[model samples]
Target: MTATRPDPEIPAKLLAWYDKHARALPWRAMPGEPAPDPYRVWLSEIMLQQTTVAAVKPYFAAFTQRWPDVAALANASDEDVMAAWAGLGYYSRARNLVKAARFVAELGGFPETEEGLRALPGVGDYTAAAIAAIAFGRRAVVVDANVERVVARLFAIEEPLPGARKAIRAAADRITPDERSGDFAQAMMDLGSRICTPRAPRCDACPLAADCAARGHDPQRLPVKAPKKVKPVRRGRAFWIEREGCVWLVQRAPEGMLGGMRALPDDGWSAAGDGSGEPPLVGAWQEAGVVRHTFTHFVIGLSVRRYDGAPATVSGKGEWWPIDRLDEAGLPTLFAKAARLARAASERLL
Candidate 1:
């Protein structure tokens, strides 16, 4: 793909600004930090998906220290890896992370070209391009959210998201430089994150201010977005059976939503309209309360039911633990939130 030359002064402008004001992040090595490590960059990118840099910082530090390298991550057990990613929300990303690590480890290293990177388990068009350019110093275009906003507003494109994503990608490709591709990619990413913010973008400090179509006309309204699709609501029941200050917790199925994460014993949730399924427990059930949680595409309403004088074991699955020690378990955020609500209500009713 032909790369577009940003205004001759744009790169010079952006790099100068970056030199003075780049956010200090751990994953970011300074200009000469042994060139970019494809393994580290790939790992950080995967973990950063749909997660904020602040939220991902601790997890990234922990993982790098514990595993240290792609080969170490590849050899980690599923349980260990999942536990390490406990509160990051999207469990699938963690699973894919390990899969990709193993694949790359076996192959010796990440592909230096976009096509080769795309062949890895979770690497898509954007990710492949990012790795190819940022880590391997290849001339590839990267159009992440930051880059998209920068491109969309720069050209004053009004297409909605997802629909507009492709055009934005094309536009970004045009501006990427053949030389210093790594620095060029980082420069754009940094510019978008810092100056070209979605709200109240600091146009005065922007390097491409002269070429910015949005700034030239109406910066605030350039990159228009279509309305978001409504997320569906889902419902289910969670059995909060407690005895002697201990709560019953279950491990989700090995595959599927919230898979392998620790959770309260629950009636399998359904996407349908009603929630009348059998409680994932035995004994006379009573309505304790209800807890509601929202996922990206769906909202989940979990009705809390309480069972008293229940047997020590539920026969076929999960484990019961001291209620106070729930923190030690690898529970996802949603379930952990629900558990807190359930326990407080349980205390109130008793």
Candidate 2:
């Protein structure tokens, strides 16, 4: 499938718009500025996957401040990185980030090409292209979600996504200029995010408005998406064992859902268990409440049960995390929500 070239003026117009309206992201180097550090670019791109820019900002800042560079990240322990990335969702990305950091550190520096970057863990086509263009000043075409939307709208591509991705990439390739390719890619992203939005696109403010085929049509409907499969709802149970002002928090298995994060002991809830599993302790367990959390594949209702028995008898491969400093334990969002529910129940009992 061949993609027709976009209007020759599109690049210049878009670059002009980008020069004025480029987002002031922590990891981005402004137009005409030196390329951003590859480490920062790589880190931000990994974190930004399926995540919002607003949500990623603090995480980016935190990770960079703590690790500072690829070497530092490589040297950090896996538990520490996983904990820091707890609420960010997608535990695997954090794992891969550490692995890739070690790989890069061993190689002595980041690879400068998309193909080379792709060889690293977690650096897929989009990420490799983004790093190559934005961090290494390469002419690679970078197509992210925002760029996909802008391209789809600009060319009025009507095919549904996943299927339309090929044409979208070709269209993106057509518009990506040889000069300042990184800036061009960022410009398209900024345009899509700020002006050519999913709904109620600001066509009047768009630099590519003159060339956009979807501009006259219902632009919002250009990039049609196939229906999403309904996420299955699952039920589970989590135990809140408290003693001496601290809670029993266990580290998850090294591999699987929410792997390696510190979490409240539970009846194997991570597998979407039927909530019928026995409590870790053999004692009176009272229902604290339920905590609802959504994972990628399923939604779960975790029944928070409190241990009414003596804590001294409960034994496990876990730590006694202070209830007051539960925040520092780096529990995943699901467990974090469960903790809040249990804490409220304990307060009521007090």
Predicted candidate 1 versus true structure: per-residue lDDT over 195-282, tens digit per residue? 8987889998887888887886767675677777897888788777778778777778867888877778776675545466687655
Q: What is candidate 2's CA lDDT for residue 300?
A: 91
How well does candidate 2 match the true structure in TM-score terms? Answer: 0.95
In model 2, how large is the Cα lDDT of residue 14?
A: 92
Off by over 4 Å in 2: 1-5, 270-273, 313-316
Best by lDDT: 2
Candidate 1 residue pairs that clash = 4-174
Task: State the lDDT at 325 in candidate 1.
Answer: 77
lDDT of 2 by residue, 165-253 (tens): 99999888888899999899888888888998888999999988889898889998868988888888878889998888888889988
Model 1: CA > 4 A from native: 1-6, 243-246, 286-288, 322-324
